[model samples]
Target: MAQHWIATRPGDLEVFSFEPYDAPAPRSGEVTIEVRAAGMNPADAKHVARGRDEDFPRPIGYEVAGVVTAVGPDTEIGSGTVTVGDEVLAFRISGGWASEVTVAASAVFAKPASLSFAEAANLLLAATTAAEMLHVTGVGEGDTILVHGASGAVGVSVLQQAAMLGARAIGTASGSSFGVVERFGGTPVAYGDGLEQRVRDAAPDGVVAALDCVGTDEAVDVSLATVADRSRIVTIAAPDRAKDEGFIAIAGALPESQAYRDSVRADLVRLAGEGRLVVPVARTFALADAVEATELLMGAHPGGKLALEP
Candidate 1:
């Protein structure tokens, strides 16, 4: 028997329960893992917070890193062939808050030797989202962009990935989180009154795009005022604003976005493997402390990503 977390009913963290579970043999194209680390993100909780009655018994984690324990016959992992005992990471997996999981082989990739299990577990969701933002905005060499919530995980990824594309980022961050923005090669600006002016001053050459991780109206308004091309503006947080204003909004759940994210996972892993991309993990909690860790993640910035060490 293995242990895993689940939401017995739709609600908040109180509904989460850790229970004994039996992982079954993998079907074709499926693989089972002895989970080492499980990534924690806002969506893990938000997706189950409120939904239809039928969505109950939802799993609590989205990504994880582990050793491959079993594979369906003749299965090929996403990056290539995988064997038992292989160290790997998987994304878009259900019931990841467990000691073992059975997930589609296509979602698994070789874990980089350079990244700790915790870092690899925390990698894809935020990194792939950032990659999609940069792609849709047409960001490239010599481009300058504005990023909202730049200290957050997605925003931090945006800062680093933007730099890789030979683009410059002018990021909005709290006074305390300014270091994170600067460390990732972004120019940090306080996100409050006069934000538009602050961004302009930081990027005198001009901001060709704006990516919003923070959904505040201020973020939307400032982005609207700063970027000349509305089509170059994108938001992961403000879907209503995207519909109302006609820019762009994307989520991992959407088919197009999911395709884009899935396509880029291997490249992102390769980058991390080479130590070119970094996952800023702030803390790792024991499996039993997941609820407390999640409470903190939902509150003030923990300064970086959080993970569950199973």
Candidate 2:
């Protein structure tokens, strides 16, 4: 029987047991995958905890790295582009925390041989979002960009991408995560009281643009105060508040362009393959221990991305 994690109500997580339904044969444009590792993000638990009032169970996860098990008829992705045992990373429209999943061929990418299932699983959403924000803001070589909350998965992706683009980057994190920021080639500044002054000192000349991965009032205020162009300042967090504060707001979870997704996947895989990217995995749990994993993910001081192995 295939096992899956499901949430039936707000703040509830349960392992639903079911008989092994025959794996669905892929349709014309679909591919079936045997999931190996599922990456969990904050949005997974938040969406479950704020479930719809009608009381329907919702399957949660969005990114997974697995092996292609089946391919649909009349599709270009025959057993060749991806084969029965070829490893792959997929970005599902919904419901990825399962023993198996069906996805559109477009959302699947060949997993780089250098990345483990765990690292591939963590790449899609966070890396894609960071790449999109950097692209949209026109951050390029020689530009100076500031990233708020520079220690999280998304934040680290931004720091790395900015550096690859030859831009000078300054990232803010708690004192403890400063080393992580620096490792990603960013000047690290401490957040909290006196945050603005800290950032100012780190990038004394001035910041040409800013990206807010943290969504705090301090982050917003500091960016607005330091950047010369508001249009160049973007926030992945606090979208509504960013609009009110006159900064560009982009949603990382829902990327607007398929090309953007492809670009992110390529960049993530390439950097990882070349040992230029570092995806820190703080903890891991078997699929059966998803509840405990989610709890730790929601708690403070759990450093790095968390993954679930199926």
Candidate 3:
């Protein structure tokens, strides 16, 4: 039987047994992947705890990287575009936290050979969210960007992407995590009392844009105070409040366009392949320790991207 982590109900992590069904052959335009590592994100726990659709026994996960074990019939991916045994990374509709997953060909990309399983798994969600924010807000070279919660996985991704685009990035993080932000090519400002003044000191000319990964009222208020164009400020965390405050808001659960996923996947893979991207993974858990992993991820301590290896 293939192993998978299933949350049978809200607020607990339990394993439900499953008989190994034959790996479903992909239909045309689909491909099957043998998952090596699953990226654990906050949304996974939130969905399991909150129960988004009443679909109990839900398999929760969004990003994975592994090898192509099978491809669907009549699909170009089967004919060497993505051959059997090709290493790949995928973003799935569901069931990513599993031993195997079937995804659309368009959704799977070649995993860079240079990346470890954990690093490859870490790329999808945070990197994709950062890419979408940059795209929708039209931030570009020479722009000064202020990023909130700059030490989290999404915050680090945003800092790297902004730097790659030739923009000046000023990131706000707790004093303990300031070094992380600075290592990713961002100017780090402490995020607390006098945050506005700290940001001004970092970017004397003023921040032209802001991306909020932390939903604090303080983050929102300081971003609003610093950026001249409210439309140029976007928030991924506090969508409701962001809307109330007139800043552009985006949610990973509800993105502006489907193509946004494709763009992020492409950019991330290319960057990792070329050694230009950094995926800081602070911890990894074995598949058997999934429950513990979830608990740690939910904790208040500082860490980078965490993954579960199977």
lDDT of 3 by residue, 1-310 (tens): 4577777777745533232434467888998888899898888887777774478867778888889888787665411378889998877457777788787887788888899988999887888888888887788999999999889988888888898889989999888998899999999999889999999999999999999988899999998999989989988878888768887888755645456765567767888789888898988888667778878887875379888887
Q: Candidate 3: global Cα-lDDT?
A: 0.81
Candidate number with the higher lDDT (1 or 2): 1
lDDT scores of the candidates, listed in order: 0.93, 0.80, 0.81
| RMSD vs true structure, all candidates | 0.8, 2.6, 2.3
Clashing pairs in 3: 26-72
C-alpha lDDT (0 to 100) for residue 170 of candidate 3: 94
User: Which 10-residue span in candidate 1 carries the lowest summed lDDT?
Assistant: 50-59
Query: Per-residue lDDT of 63-178 in model 1, one digit per residue for the tens?
Result: 99999999998899999998999999999899888899999999999999999999999999999999999999999999999999999999999999999999989999999999
Q: Candidate 2 — what's its lDDT?
A: 0.80
Q: TM-score, each model? A: 0.98, 0.91, 0.92
Structure candidate 1, residue pairs in collision: none
Which residue ranges in model 3 land beyond 4 Å of their true spot? 12-23, 77-80, 255-257
Compare the candidates by lDDT and give the number of the best one.
Answer: 1
